[model samples]
Target: MNENSSCCTPEDSRHSGGTDVQVGEVTTTYKITGMTCGHCEGAVSSEIGEISGVSSVQAVASTGLVTVVSKAPLDEEAVRAAVDEAGYELVGQGV
Candidate 1:
């Protein structure tokens, strides 16, 4: 499988620097609205995952929340744009 597919499996604490690097896993939860079904979840997840530095995304329609877990240096604009592109509005971001 490719590198991206490999990442989809799980989150591992392997450092390419060949050292024990403690990467800060910042999980930002975004409150979104207008998500009505599973397709909406897929769209939001895909859009956010395309942004650089965004390691993974797990979006839930019922909760109207999208949890994005990534390493340091997150682009807030990119996250917002991704949500906008998915035809949803980001109410707020925290955590």
Candidate 2:
């Protein structure tokens, strides 16, 4: 079997809109500072999505929440770096 076959079965793919299943993936939510608009959200999302192993990112300026999906838990330092690159501050992990 292919390396990814064990991660998800055909039925699982059907439920996810036919997207490839990410096995062993983890999700994290972080509180971000200085985001005030859609542009800010896009910037933060773009920066975080560029990190290795990151599969998806969602940033909400109104809530100051940034959710990240990746193959594993990301290093705090790495997240800080991405936030910094986007001209923002990583306040901390979300509650």
Candidate 3:
């Protein structure tokens, strides 16, 4: 998360082994509130994409589910902030 860190790229920052990396194709699902339509989904997706570690984000408005794929591990605070910045609340998280 350092400003000058060259590890900003998805490939560079990803955790390769051990407890630091959860193992497998790790992904987290977050329940987002206030996403009533595709526009809301787009807003959420855009915000999540700005996070350095995130590889991809898919927001489903019907389910209000945000699935984030990060080449590197992601922090809980980063997830929360992305959702919050998109004008949504993260109601839950699952590994």
Candidate 4:
């Protein structure tokens, strides 16, 4: 692929009925359950960071939020799997 080529086509850029926006980078927030401390946050962030294309991950246990910034929109199932691997439950995208 050329440098100008995007991993996702225009149609693939939008997820869950256009809720996710991809412009150079995509930032998606996922709600999680069972995160009650800093250790939980670190585990979740580390797991999600291992996913391909993920640039950064910030997990806040206080709010049970895991914000992932990536080069492209990520597959929800993959995210859920990461959370599961971190010993947490992915409650889907945040509202």
True-structure Cα RMSD, model 3: 10.9
Q: What C-alpha lDDT does candidate 4 achieve relative to the native structure?
A: 0.72
Off by over 4 Å in 1: 1-22
List, residue by residue over 1-89, the lDDT tens digit for candidate 2: 11111211121110112235377989788999887766677677777888899888878777989888889899989999988887788
Find the 10 residues in a row with the least total lDDT in model 1. 1-10
lDDT of 3 by residue, 1-95 (tens): 21211221132122222324335545778888777666676777878878886766777767988887777768878888877876788887843
Q: Which of candidates 2 and 4 reaches a greater TM-score?
A: 2
Clashing pairs for predicted structure model 4, backbone only: none
- C-alpha lDDT (0 to 100) for residue 79 of candidate 4: 96
Q: Give the worst 10-residue stretch by lDDT in candidate 2.
A: 7-16
Q: What TM-score do all the candidates reach, one by one?
A: 0.70, 0.76, 0.69, 0.75
Clashing pairs in 2: none
Query: How many residue pairs collide in each prediction?
Result: 0, 0, 1, 0
Query: What digit string (tens of lDDT, one per residue) describes model 1 on residues 3-33?
Result: 1111123222111112233478777788888
Global lDDT scores for all candidate models = 0.66, 0.73, 0.67, 0.72
The number of the candidate with the highest lDDT is 2
